[model samples]
Target: MSDTKILTLIEAVTAALDHEMGLDKEIVLMGEDVGKNGGVFRATDGLQQKYGDERVMDTPLAEAMIAGLSVGMAAQGMKPVPEIQFMGFVFPAFNQIATAAARMRNRTRGRLTMPITFRMPYGGGIHAPEHHSESTEALFAHIPGLRVLIPSNPTRAYGLLLASLRSPDPILFLEPKRVYRMVKHEVEMNGVALPLDKCFVDREGDDITLISWGAMMHETLLAADQLAKDGVSVEVIDVATVAPMDMETIFTSVRKTGRCVVVQEAPRAGGLGSEIAAEIAEHELMSLIAPIGRVAGYDTIMPYAKMEMQYMPSVERVVEEAQKVLKYV
Candidate 1:
């Protein structure tokens, strides 16, 4: 029998959680509709039945309480994985996440470490309501002592979530719900965890480099395929761990290509794309063949269902931006 099974990104998440919870009894899950309801996206299906109420818990519809309780539990030596349901709903838990959970280890002089994984479904494209489709990952990425992580595919989702569960610090595990079931990968059940703070180069090319994460990675890859057909060799990178970004890999890619384009589903202003562009401009400007390009969402509130697609960065937009960058000089 094959050890590796085909699983979607969200299924990989469940597999990771189940594997870790079995190995470590100290790990517990808490969130709204996460237990019996299996999470709004069914990411936690059958976990409650397997681990029972204590390990896989369904909490009140209170984001603050969930985060606060996770912080306390983690401080007491328990690995608590709390779900915020949606990224837009996490603001209420900011006090606990930013002020407490993030600072626990440093404040306690390494005596108390918070092994907490705060999970949330983020990004647009699911036709969700007003507060359900925001992709404000930069908010938590700006917080000190917090590791921001986003997985682009099933394989990385499994490995990265396992790594997050085993971490000694607080992590914001942002799941791009848009791609939760967009694709699948054959993943082995071995408890192997991918390294944190590294960029995964999905494709290698010399003409230009494309950097993206989460759901945007899907579009980026698609755009790369399209660009390739037009004779443009595009290097595609998945910025899985956004915070404490692995700029070295990106710099190396940009240095080789001498041109770069960043794609993001979040707003253009104050976005992580801006940070990547700025970093490249600062360190790799001498290697440039053209100005850095960015394809991202607008700086306005994410519109509801019908207009959600319009607000997102499409494959065409990414290609257009890359072409514009390629056209320069």
Candidate 2:
């Protein structure tokens, strides 16, 4: 295992895909521009040269066809990884994902399995044109028979992509687009299975529990650091996996701090934060010292590049919510 530094999240994802393709002959990559163009964000960069065009195929710009074909391929005992260039464009294939791809095992009465990974870059703040920035993980999480995994850092992204390739069920892997070229970290190539349902406590504190996932995690961490300067100890929890959430870790932190703030880049209404808040309210009501608060994107459609900062959650917003929750106790 070499300790190589991954300079960007896109590179980390590409490396993970490359590693998996090298180790397993059954694994094949399919998507628009994946073969020669290496995908829109280059997440599959150089894979075509390494694995050949048959293994790294570039398909038409039809998401439904891409998803349905991948399902068919997986049913035939091949592991297919399909990439949706952007999360907003994923709706074209939602029916296949929620029905055909996701329900294969149950529909077959356990006779067959569709083990496919749907990877898409999600979230805003990258200043891209409209339809290019979106956080739609909540949509997939609501669908049954599907596992949803969101990684906040390069190491987790690399590990989770490998594990998703090995999962027997279909997986919706959401990569934060805003951070795709922002951060850097060292990653190990060991095929370790990081628990998908557990949240990592990035910082331990007794004052408040700041819960966030994906790109928002970076803002939460920054807010925690800024809060620490003001003598406010903040507990940061990274919800790596959205579905089958690790309520154990979340409730534990809420019970300890008695204050919680959930943050996300998606719209506040009907988003993952709503479900998380509901869970806490239902199970840990008595332990709460304040009303569970959330910092999220506005309800309107995503704005243009100039107004993205206001459409998405910012560090200032996180700190404001933290301060509000801190006052409740």
Candidate 3:
């Protein structure tokens, strides 16, 4: 039997970080409880023991300080992978991220590179606390200098993280908290990195295009399966990198399908789906048979526990919107 064990997406995150830290002595891991406690989700488990306090050091609970410190360290010639416990808590760090880290390379006139990777778990449906669940990736996507990359599975979690670490610029790495341990897949520890700003076609079809990312990819795939049985022929595309989007891949798929349905766990207003919808309308307008459909979360704040189900876009919801788009055609 192969030595590869079935690993969840969270496990893949730990393994990938461990692999990178081993190779790059300059890569420093810092965050709240990330050292001794191994982070809130234990994604940094055992890394502190292996790399010691010098490399895998823990930080205070201040998000702004964490972001500023990481950017400062990166400016002084260090690759810092700083973790913000949850996406909701990332607000305090936004100023540093948008102003310092993202603007570093351009600000320095290409004299320096901010090889900083900001890690945070995002999205809802895990029944977590208010500050722990939020899908605000679009806020970073709209920023010019920063890059936002989201992983939908264990393999991409491993490969894309490696790529983000190797990047010359800053990267916002958002993990879908709901699916952190939802599915397991065999991912090799070969240290190979996947390309950023690229889309992965999870399923191929000829009738309609279904675009999504993060945990929502699971529901999107499920909807595609049901639509497939009904002869809808849904093509599923995972927007791996939210920023610097690989629109070419989507346009090609949309051209073939003639219809598109975008699903996002975040609110519909100013969400990444809206951006994709705009691009489709501009470039593939002639090819599209119907107006693009968006299945997304509500605009209100992500409510407490049980209400999460209603806030998140479900498989049924995606299917309903997809059906509507096809019917319009």
Error of 1 at 267 (Å): 0.2
Clash count, candidate 1:
0
User: In what order do the candidates fall by TM-score, top score first?
Assistant: 1, 3, 2
Tell me the spans in candidate 2 whose CA falls farther than 4 Å from its real position: none
Across residues 1-329, which tens digit of lDDT does each residue of candidate 1 receive? 43898999999999999999999999999999999999999989999999999999999889999999998899889999999999999999999999999998999899999999999999999997889999999988898899999998999999999999998879999999999999989999888999888999999999999999999999999999999999999999999999979999999999999999999999999999999999999999999999999999999989999988999999999999999999977
Residue clash pairs of candidate 1: none
| lDDT comparing candidate 3 with the true structure | 0.93
lDDT minimum window of 10 residues, candidate 2: 1-10
**Candidate 2 local lDDT, residue 84:** 89
Q: Which lDDT tens digits does candidate 3 get at residues 182-272?
A: 9999998888899998999999999999999999999999999999889878789999998999999999999998999999999999999
Best by lDDT: 1
Q: What does the lDDT read for residue 145 in candidate 2?
A: 89
Local distance difference test, per candidate?
0.94, 0.89, 0.93
Clashing residue pairs in all predictions, respectively, total 0, 1, 0
- Model 3's C-alpha root-mean-square deviation from the true structure amounts to 1.2
lDDT of 2 by residue, 1-329 (tens): 56676457888898888888888888989998988889989999999998899999999889999999998999999999999889889988998999898899999998779889999999888888889887878888898889899999888898888888888889999999888888998777666667766788989999899999999999999999999999998999999888868889999999999999999989899999999999999999999999998999998898989988878888999999889888874
Which of 2 and 3 is ahead in TM-score?
3
